[model samples]
Target: MILSYTNIAIKLALGLISLIIVINITGKGNLAPSSAIDAVQNYVLGGIIGGVIYNNNISILQYLVILMIWICLVLSMRWLKTNSSFFKVAIDGKPVVLISRGKLDTEACRTAGLTAHEVMFKLRSNGIYSIKTVKQAVLEQNGQLIIVKAGEENPRFPLITDGTIQLQALDSIDKTEEWLMEKLKEQDVENISDVFLAEYENGNLNLVKY
Candidate 1:
């Protein structure tokens, strides 16, 4: 009985150390997950530890091997997501425009799987009472609503994120790729890929460079 208890204690300590190592390697996203993949990783890690900790049939070496395999899989997925835009979108969906120019887009709401009542609730939580008062309402990938009130001079959204042009943002602002390129040229920026983030507000362009 004493030997069994000692084994359990050792496993508990090793499990905690493994968790710390994973978190350090993966970054803070595992601590406060913002995407579906991050959340799933957390749940799966918890299950692995929880299920194996109390199982006497599993040796410490076996448990460590399982953790190492899981970590490798997670790292590979993260690498793919970083290098491939298609995989990024597939794993973490892009934001949806739920309201544009004071009009509710039912199709967008449907795509986001949000009902009218839910939309209203989100708006009300953001202190917006009427849909007409919203210049734009963006449903972010993290399931948060970004509200832009009518007549606000602030940029509704980023024209570029992570050095990629956001065509949807251009469309929302009634602009085009050609217009963006010209504007960037005017500001002595020749490469769109050099920009990390670009925002347009009140007929002015703001850029954050890589």
Candidate 2:
């Protein structure tokens, strides 16, 4: 009972601290998070938070020591990111180009740990539909694919359907609500609420009726 109570207290303290940190952070797109450094910072924060939770039989001094060490590591990395672009790249990694100049780089695909079918699927989801239409496809470090078309006009892409928001598809097409509502109305969807879902892309709107 004593141990359990102690555990609860430690967890409460850690949770409060971690929540404050997370609340202060800005939201970001999956590929490009608001702060580039947040990726590495989270891991260390997790460890410190974890140390507080596992307070079983460990002295408060020991926990403090570990927390201090983690803080040092985080500070060191932040210091390095300021002075060394090489270190920053090594930590965060660079975007891997899967397609370049209308050609698929098979070697880059392999190195990026993506199968040909997966690459094709990502491209298709992005509205490219054909590899020939893609000028460049970059696999960002955050595991999101970024595609750039060769043409001046960005082709309309479908991003929602069946009452479910397709996040991957939306990110690929950079879609918005205004565009979605217009597409829905174009398909004679008089009420957005009446429709179960709406999908748009390639100059078309696909809707699911309630």
Candidate 3:
């Protein structure tokens, strides 16, 4: 029993050390994810450690060897990405244009398996209050949207938030409650309670509901 505990403790210590070393080399990609590849690489590296750490048959030296191999493979892939364009493009796909020239590209949306509502939601989350403000929106390889708003566009933040009204936001945008209700009616939403979020920009009302 004591031998088993000692073996496990050693494994844990070695595993943690190996994990820290690998993560240090992997850089911010494994720490704070900016893309799907980063997240996947982080998991795959962790999965390697998980699979190897507790195996009784594998000696600590063997474990180190296995982990080092993985690190080398990851570094080789990184090197290829830097050295070869084809490898880079094949591994990381090019960005797709979802919206262009202030108009929704319905075909691109369909190709990306994204709904109009989702695109607008992402846009709104990025502080875009109206579709007209967007000159081009690119769907990044990591599934994030990169929106290029029209030049020197006005800022319009949320006025109605989750069934509650923000009177200050309304006044700043020069809109009235009656106008908001009319906009809601135009969208077939009956009451303010039905509205999840709403913003007005460039003579257009951007609304989202539960």
**Each candidate: RMSD to true structure?**
2.4, 12.3, 15.8
lDDT of 2: 0.63
Which one wins on lDDT?
1
Assess candidate 2 and give its TM-score to the true structure.
0.58
Steric clash pairs (candidate 3): none
Runs of candidate 1 exceeding 4 Å displacement = 1-3, 201-204
Off by over 4 Å in 2: 18-54, 153-210
Candidate 1 residue lDDT tens string, 114-203? 999999999999999999998888998889998878877655679987778987678666778999999999989999888888988788
- Give the clashing pairs for model 2: 158-200
lDDT digits (tens) for residues 34-131 of candidate 2: 34566556655676666566566666566656666755675576567545657766766766878765788999988888998999888888777877
lDDT score at residue 30, model 1, on the 0-100 scale: 44
Per-candidate local distance difference test: 0.84, 0.63, 0.71
**How well is each residue in 70-99 modelled by candidate 3, as lDDT tens digits?**
677767766776566566667666567776
